[model samples]
Target: MGLKSFLSRPLAAYVAHQYQKWALHPEAAQQRVLQELLRLGPATAFGRDHDLAAARTAPDFQQRVPVRDYEALSPYIERIKQGERDVLWPGQPLYLAKTSGTTSGAKYIPITKDSIGNHINGAKDALLHYVHRTGKPQFLDGKLIFLSGSPELEQVAGIHTGRLSGIANHHVPGYLRRNQLPSYQTNVIDDWEQKLDHIVDETLGQPMTLISGIPPWVQMYFDRLTERTGRPVGEVFPQFQLFVYGGVNFEPYRRKLLDSIGRPVDTLELFPASEGFFAFQDEPGNPGLLLLADAGIYYEFIPAERFFEPNPPRLTLAEVELDRNYALVVSSNAGLWGYSVGDTVRFVSLRPHRVLVTGRIKHFLSAFGEHVIGEEVEQTLREALQQFPEAEVVEFTVAPRVSDTATEPSRHEWLVEFARPPHNAAAFAAALDAGLRRRNVYYDDLLRGNILAPLQLTPLPAGAFQRYMKSQGKLGGQNKVPRLSNDRVLADGLLRA
Candidate 1:
């Protein structure tokens, strides 16, 4: 038997056993995690500053450490980068996970040994749960291709620095590393387009059972693969069983990615950021992904509608109600305390603490009180794609078009790059406009009053978004199109690109 087959069965069984204990008693799991964080709190500088060493309970901890974001925590991060010890975490960080400067400029999120453990093992445990629940362990016996960034890290102020994906990819166990496709040498190719070509060449002949990447890049790789092989993905790798993805909401790309994959495969969604690996798909019957309450992270939630309150109420796992949108706050082993990661999520289950990533708390287009979110735009786009079954939108962004002249009333401009252009482009745009009308009351009212023009579809060339990302040095790894911007910066920039 192969090494993966020989080792996977016991691993899956153990993960299943552990998952049951965590899922059935989420509140208890969370409580334990909080207690652990509180224990570790005293050793670091942040803990002493907040009197975390003496803080005995969750209430005491909450009273001392308020909710903060990267801006608030920037000083500590800078200190850590300057070779300071026990600034955020217990000591100097092993690395700085460089997140794409989207909402905030490029953020160097600290990654300690403890935080990296959560990043790696959390994903592993989630996959193990999948294997245990599905009664399928054979997929684990084959090569698992992780479409990630360069593993070669640069030393910055004695701290290794690179993409979080790269750091995590560097740490894969020797056994799994053997099963992982694409050479480390090839994986480090900085140019994303060139990297993708090398990946396509390396993995095309492997026994690929599982593949993981952000959606747009996966679609790009799949298109290249299909064109080269003249075969569907299912035919190419008949044993391919799962597609694991994250970085952006999957609804818009679901049909397109599925079409490229050429068959239905069990898909798992992950909510991992540079800060920490937070949540993952656990159970089939359950509604959102199961929150990792027991992972090396303590979480708090603020209702999204009221997140702007001067002192918004922060709810713990036990306090978060089902079906309400909440902005996530986290205090992790990496030394971030009560930091809002900017993403908003809706809980689907309270029992196991499952959640759906709804939208970004900071990302929205409300130029005319339309209050449109990434989720809404993506939903509209998904529904619009239904009218043109043959066409697929690879990547897209939206901007509000406010006009000075009477000829152009304020409206939304969609800069969409199609993987497969629709047969009738006008019909596709109309369907998209109709979708927004149905989904958004403000949009519908604007249309009814003729205060808004029909949604403008500026169809972009294929790989337009990729080229823009490349030019910006953000071609891959958790970077994505900003879906709903209030200004025309992205649209205008894409035009130039």
Candidate 2:
């Protein structure tokens, strides 16, 4: 190997060694983490200790806590909204991550110092492990780019001071903090539209080797970059080597991004939220993400088979079966104990403890009582796309809507966009319908009764989702397209001419 490759090999080896050591002894690592959580706070620690103790004593400790939705925690969330300090934890929270959740409106998720540290450490582990696997030098010895949410600190009565993304940004090492692009002091909050334009314009010619953000916003930024430079994105910023994305799935937009850049780029998916950075894709070739089990968070999974049941057992990492879908529940250092964030995941393998995100538990449609899930929809789309190689769905939303004419009381509508006019829209829809029916029997019955009409293939004008996002004041920074819509109002608004 050459000098640069030789130097990187040893670093890669070191990272791999660490990852292997952790993987081999996850229980030991979690036990040590439990001790640390105890040190953080008695109540914070006591909750976990109680659960563990309960698990040890109960016939099936994993089955004790029923699968709960966010509604279960609404009362506590309301207490936080009312300015209560110790509602979730012992002391005043350090910050709140303002996230625009589906339908429930904006939620100010509390984040404490311990939780912040967990996020940082989890990220560090992921990065170190990556360097070890690839043996690639950290391209930017300079600044790192993190296209994050608005850093506006909320000043609500009794609410925390710091914004989630901003607080995380602030926690970066003092020396590296200055290297952050878009200095935190700029009033990028007041004029979001102008700010996005400025961010795109200013960074056009910079030596930014790494870019990270949500997929939708990144696409918008690239679109703007291409417009501004009057050249393809790759020509404007050829040096960018790595793109790190988190908070949403990037699979659907992968091809578009590759086309824009003119070449394949290294992409890393991070499983992070306001709660904590739970996992990351350890190696580019790995099938599932490696969980940061050592982070100050305890994880549980509700098996897919029991997901809709009134009370589904919550299995720990060890108790969970491999290759089955499960709803993720987390008890973190952020004071969220036995919390179900609504995201769904499945284990691709168990020996290495790697997991793949299947879908959001709440983002499914089962109006026919068939229990259709996000994974089923994703799989159906994947199969349909493979059959019709000429067609590409730019954006889509699936929902149960009744026909206004009352002929079909219950029918499913899919608002979809194609790259260009399909050779046969009807055939494409039929293929999708067949795929769905085969994968989910309930959908088949619904289709037979015309309860679910032939999937409506609506061709969205180019940049339609982008335009919608801009109108919603979420043009840039960590915002993504709504993958599934249950309500008719938002769906109709999105579909309207």
Candidate 3:
């Protein structure tokens, strides 16, 4: 083995050993994290206003601070944006992770010096887990391509402001800087299409080993590489060993992505967001991601059904159960107190606190009280795709199709874009409908009661989703189309497009 791999093997082993301590004793780790957050809470304005200093225990903290979304916390965020110090966390944050918001248009999430370690270390530990488990660390020797937002930053009240990925770019460790791919000039291009082309040109001849990004964008990169080289991704970059992805479920895009790669590759899934780096897949063949209990974030969960209630019951690590959907809440060292990041999760394993990100809390279909989630749709599609091995899904979304007239029955409409359309589309649709019924009793009851018709599949033109996203100016860098919606706004817009 060469110098890098030889050194990485021991390092990976050491990191994995250190990580397992917290994974094994998650509740203890969480208690410690909570105490640390509580200790730091008194230095900020939000801390003073919420009486965080008076909170001695989890219940005390919960009682003092109510769960809040971005809009609810924007007043303090605005104060920070206007150059105020110690508004949320201590003094000023190192950077602001700007994300697209629903009602607020744009959200600026604080990333303090205290909390940045969670983001960086979570990613490092995930890779280390893979290296230690498989004894394969040669990927570190070649160029690592991270398809991300531009590294360029704009100052917001003396703080560097950009997408979370962009903010992270400034912090890439010096050791790995030599291996990082896609030149800074290429990354700075504003238009995604243009940046992608420049990236392809720059890395076309390089020895790329690791590729990481949101699934869709990485797939796009793979497609461009294959189109240009007239060879599969594996043939083009034989050293490419790892696929690191997050932001969307990989199951839905697995077939197409694998086809593009032209071979099997080890994959790692992360549960990261603007708010914090929450979890990462630590074991091969495991669907669950191990939660970072000691990541300077105190986590809470409210049952998804009772999330909007006047006073939802908040459960901590010790109180949560397996397989129940819960809206994820956190009070991080970054100054967020009892903040709901809008994502819902289901615990698959409680021993090490492993979880699967089920869906967004607001991004569900409850138009007819069926209440289908992103996990259900993605899972149903994944199962349906299995029976029809020939079909390769590119992208898809679902929305309620309610008729204007009373005579017609309402049904769910699935807008799918396929790389390889199924041979028998009707049979595939039937399989998906059956799977949904099997998964959700409410949906099954609606079907049996004749209140809803079987779902309708609309085969969208290839690249239709991309075109739609492009039109919305959300073409790249962590933006994803919702899996399902309660209304026809997205479906109508898609059909019209």
Off by over 4 Å in 1: 1-3, 102-104, 285-287, 364-497
Worst 10 residues of 1 by lDDT: 98-107
lDDT of every predicted structure (CA atoms): 0.80, 0.65, 0.85
lDDT of 3 at 241: 93
The clash tally of candidate 1 reads 0
| Rank by TM-score (best first) | 3, 1, 2
Q: What is the C-alpha RMSD of each candidate to the true structure, in Å?
A: 13.8, 14.2, 14.0
Cα lDDT tens digits for candidate 2, 197-286: 778756867866677776545665676677787876667767677788776556645776667777767878888877678789988877
In terms of lDDT, the best-performing candidate is 3
Q: For residues 344-427, could you state the per-residue lDDT of candidate 3 as single tens digits?
A: 899999778899988767788755545477777888999999999999999999988754332565789999999999999999
Q: 1-497 in candidate 1: lDDT tens per residue?
A: 56676577788898778777878788888788888888887888888889998787778888999898777888888888888898877878989987643223457899897888889987887788777778766777888989876788998789999878789998887767878978988887766667778888998888899999876557667877887899988889899998888876565567867887778888888888888989888875454888888788888999998999998888888888888999999998888899988888998887777889887787787555454667677888888788789988888999877654324455789999888889998999899888777666556645664556798899888778888889899889998778888667788889888
> Of models 2 and 3, which has the larger lDDT?
3
Q: Worst 10-residue stretch by lDDT in candidate 3?
A: 401-410
Candidate 3 yields a Cα-based lDDT of 0.85
Top candidate, metric TM-score = 3
